[model samples]
Target chain A: MIKVEWFYWLCGAIFIAVAALTFADGTNAKRYGSGAFWGLLGGAFIYSTFVVHKTAPASVLGLAVIMMALLVATGQLGRGDTTGPSRAEQEAGADRFGNRLFVPALTIPVVVIIFAVGLAKIHVGSEPLLEKSSETLIGLGVASIVAVIIGFVMLRPKSPLAPLSEGRRLLEAIGWAAVLPQMLATLGQLFVAAGVGKQVGRLTEHVLPSGSLFGGVLVYCVGMALFTIIMGNAFGAFPIMTAAIGYPVLVQHFHGNAAAVFAIGMLAGFCGTLCTPMAANFNIVPAALLEMKDKYGPIKAQIPTAIPLLACNVALMYFLAF
Target chain B: MLVLLGVLLVVIGFALRLNPLVVVTVAGIVTGFLGHLSVIAILNAFGNGFATSRSVTLFVLVLPVIGLIERFGLQEQGRRLIARLHALTTGRLLVLYLLIRQISSALGLASINGPAALVRPLIYPMAEGAAERRFGRAIPEAMREKVKGYSASADTVGQFFGEDIFVAIGSILLITGFVDTTYHLKLDALNVALWAIPTAICAYAIHGTRLFLLDRRLDRMAEAAGLTTRPDKADAQEAGR
Candidate 1:
């Protein structure tokens, strides 16, 4: 039975390789800090599940992971050299291969879709190819491996390790920002448990006049957009906003269509994504990469679009979600 | 009031520009403790939360593949391919890419044109090249910058509206999880994705027009402040090879 645990073990092994390479990277200034950061995360993954039961004590595991997060958060965890092939090499290869370079790139989603559906029904001697319940996640893991194989066959780099080294280099460049989603999700769960959602519900209820469904939907949509801008991620904002304004007001008070309400609510959040420096990857990074004089250039071009789109989401939810 | 501290911590932390990982960790720990959970219990919540959300970072798997692809010169090939196409202007090129990015993302192929993977290398260069050719010389820095900005926003606009249309994506799953857990409403993912279509269309119309207008701005810049000349090309031209 190919289950989720095996997938984690696979992930744990990859984290180990990341750690080993971090250790081996001689060019990094604070190599030990970088190595320990990845190494400790690798340990957490491997030992937390131990392929089945979590072998590590919760306190020990917690403290160690917390310490590592602290190290990463405090900016102590360093980065390795991220320089890759020079422009000359890149263009030379581009000249040789042309558009065929996309073959390896496109392999990923192709393999993922096939595995996601195919594995569920394929039988092996009166048994399915995968344990049936969580086929999607497992399929994703298998697809990644398949994509790697396709990459090797297509690219045929000078050495097999080229992929791993390049991968590690990119991973290290992303660094502390990489785990922001996981950390934010944890915070979201804590906020829910701490009754923050209830507080937000109360606050929104007081602010909006009672029993106005349109008012409730409008508040909810606008709040979601504004809050996503503040938080920098719509995913992080979704749980809290949904629990607070969305569930209590939009869904229950108005008895709105849950699907339309939440879907449009998240879209509203993306409008915020369009107009914020907080979404650095989308807005700021491109400005920087393009060598724009104004760092907020993307946000400027996007605000007009984001505002109208946000208004459309509000109006759409008010109409469709009912 | 104590429960609200977690919200306060996040706002203040982010506004203060603190490290996000630290801010969130502190918020989680503080909220857990105030909710009367013991330290071990808080840690346990942290552990389980991290464990369960492993799927969130599955993009890590494809990152290496993308890195390898880039290292093998995908971006340059894209640039070269763009240079060969004579009909593309800045506005038209960006709009075309926006469509491609959005449609592919809707199909759950978002990684194909991601910021690091596509925009920085392929999209920026191609857009720059088109703008350079349109202006009859190196475009002014300001115009080039706006072109880059629009290029970047194209990817963002594409994925934002596009991803939700694929019901299996994380945000859709998040909705399924939310509605099920919160309202006891068993909403189908496809329903949410279907409703998302109109909103996606609206986003496309709004952002696509902005991209299209960028061409006029490029023309204005070229006319007013003569194009900046660049020193290169003794290196090698496309057909010269």
Candidate 2:
């Protein structure tokens, strides 16, 4: 009885397919490097899920990380291909689809949200439709399937492989930014696991005006923003700031509303996203993509917006948290 | 202490602009070891964490579909649709998108559009079409760049402010989980979502103003440069080239 997890298998299948495509094409200068990179990751995923060799999972997983590390060390995972459709062809597509093109384009997010957030509390006999926890993650996968189906119906891609190949091209273009969230999050865990948060908390307490609620709130929000600006990710900054200043000072001593504090706290960090180049994905990438004369054009436009938003968030959190 | 050195590793690595993957892996290994996870254990954690959190990139699943759509002319359709609206200006277009993006993101649909997916193909072109309407030819690349900036920022503003309003969003969840686990304080996700409404509105109003004004600025700037809304190919050709 090999109980294979279908989801992992699907993802693993895609990775392996992409790896094969990379190897088959062999057009990119970094073709060998990227092919090996994807192949190893795909192999790790497939083996870990299917083999059910309980003892081997950890070591196998370890090897994948090492493989990735080597790829990074050797600079092997460079992108191979980036050619896309010309303007004439793309315009021709718009003429054909006309107004109907949005049908597929819009399907994904609508389906994702409905499945991710809509069915959270529903019961199917004994168990919930989704696990009470991890509903969002599971639902995201389902929504993707539904969207892909919708795409097939709407676009009627000439062949099934069309979408897979297109997916690979875009995935390669996105490259590391695709898995960035997971990578940064692991760092967050490490920070907490290593008590980085606790130490920051100590330093924060000493520097702050003692017993001042305003001080605490301001410090927490500002700290989160600053840290996120540095880290290039609000999610990464959340654990550290909460540990150092957010949780202990705002949530514990002052007994602020954790929901309001953190909800607004994260928004504050996003203001940093608008202001800093470190958040390349958000600020810099778009600027670079647009080929703006001022490289910081987006940031310049956003500063007025970010500052006002941050101020409002702080005031909102301060008043509401109590 | 020794554990805090992991922070230094991240800071230095990023400052040096090393490949982020390498930097984060090194930081993770150092932190894992310092935190007392064996090397093998750390690897297992990495593998599991990567697998589970892979949900964020589930947008990749949407990419192929998006690619196919783009291949077929979704962006061309977008421009065609925008062209039909005689009065549409660059600012108005961006402002409308900002509202739609924020509202959808509030509904937890941030992935509906992104730089590579939507802006490049659809939104930027529509905005450029509007700019072309005014400049009477191809807009100067500089004005084209401004339009692109506004188009991209709209998505960011919408997502950053709007996503938090969805109670089930990860940021809100992180907050709820932290409070319940550490302080034994139960918080309502709905309350967070509701409070987020005002901020969302404020963001819309604030950025919305800038976007609206951006069109006026573009028009004035174009005029300052002696450009016109009438498509004069001779002048346009010279300026564009």
Candidate 3:
């Protein structure tokens, strides 16, 4: 059976190659910082393979992560002067390629769907063809490779390295915010290990009033949203809020339906997902991707929607959960 | 309790606008120390989590394809397509995308659209194209910025609300697993997914209305910028047609 690790290695190779390209680009003002940052991230991916096999110590990987964070924290990373096909060329390509330009781009999702939904359960003599645990991620990795090959076939660049150079340009544009999601996920893990969730749960329990169903439900929904805002993900906040008030007070004391309460509760946390920059992939990364002047543009756009939706969640939980 | 200092640090750091990487690293270390872990143990925790979370950064792999198509005018093509449609106002286009994004995600094809894959390349350009068609000029930077926000918002709101309605999705599985294992409730994942429908409908209604309002907002901006002398008459004629 194929595993996700193979795809990770492929990804690592791409990053390392991009880093090398960055190092070679004489136009980049902070080439050393940019090179080391990408190079180190690439090494982490490659090193993860060994760490999984118990050969390399994970702490070493830990140290590498810190070094990387230091690089970003100290403002060492900078964008290179790499440019893509100019506007005139792009327009010419558009006129020449027309809608066919969409073909390679659209292939990504098509291939991912085919693998994730269509071929997830294929087997050879009862041995699964895909790694069941990470089928979606593996599908993404496969889809990316397939799309790149198609792009090469369709776009037919003069240089084989155009794809990497273009990708490096976009990645440099995103800069540190590109890695912020993973960093937040790491922080979530640290928060868990430190029993921070337990303390928060305790604090919530202490703060809640006794035996009022509305209070219980209200607090649980708000708590989920509040915690998610801080943690940057509902997944991190769910367990803590659930344990704090969701299970004991709402479900046990007030007799709310577990399915409705928890389901809507998780959605409530998503409202928080909209409001916070900590959910970097959802909030901050999009701004960077769009090259917006305001880094908080997406979050600001989302807050109007998030606040009302959060209120809707509260009302929905009250009316439907019971 | 002192370990909660990490959370405090995150809040203060963000408020003070420090480098998040620096803030997060410091907060994690301080939190671990308070929790009585050794320096090595803290490193191990950070490393272990970072390695496991590599999937989050898998988006990097798709960047090359995005970069390539973009270089070759994928966005320009999108703009041309929207321009040909003629009737697709900026608001109408986003609502259509939100509906498609939400429904497709509900059917478990959440990866079909994203900022890198679709929005930056296709949706935003198309939306902007529609706006340019409406105003008959280059949109002011502020209005262009608002369109960007809404375009990205459509994808996000659509994904967040729609993904939960699919039973096989992670949020449903997580809800069921947590409740069943912790409380011995034997909850059905379907019940959890079923409960998501009401909120899903509300999400569409609420956000869909905001998107509609976006069209009105754009028209008002166009009028204020003196881009249109007879904005209401033109809008009325367009609506009539």
DockQ, per-model, please?
Answer: 0.41, 0.35, 0.39
CAPRI level of candidate 2: acceptable
Error of 3 at B238 (Å): 6.7
Instruction: For each candidate, give the interface RMSD after superposing the true interface residues on Cα.
Output: 3.8, 4.7, 6.4
Off by over 4 Å in 3: A208-221, A224-304, A314-322, B88-201, B210-241
lDDT of 2 by residue, B30-127 (tens): 98898888877777756654443333334445567767776677656655653453346778878888887787677655654667666776778877
Q: Spell out the clash pairs found in candidate 1.
A: none
Better of 1 and 2 by lDDT: 1
By lDDT, the candidates rank as 3, 1, 2
lDDT measured at residue A48 in model 3 versus the true structure, 0 to 100 = 80
- The alpha-carbon deviation from the true structure for residue B130 of candidate 2, after best TM-score superposition, in angstroms, is 7.9
TM-score of each: 0.82, 0.78, 0.73
lDDT of 1 by residue, B54-173 (tens): 555555666677678778786677556544543466687788878877887776566545677677777778777767755655566777777777888888898889988864466765
Off by over 4 Å in 2: A1-5, A43-59, A116-118, A209-214, A231-236, A247-263, A280-293, A319-322, B35-38, B44-48, B51-54, B84-94, B101-198, B213-241
- Per-residue C-alpha lDDT of model 3 across residues A118-142, encoded as one tens digit per residue: 6777997888898864566667778
lDDT of 3 by residue, B1-241 (tens): 8988887887677556677777878888998899998999999888876776666566678778888888888756655653554357789888878887787677554644578767897789888877876787667898999999998999899999998875545566566545543455666555577799998898899899999899899888988887853354574477468
> Model 2, residue A270: what's the lDDT?
83
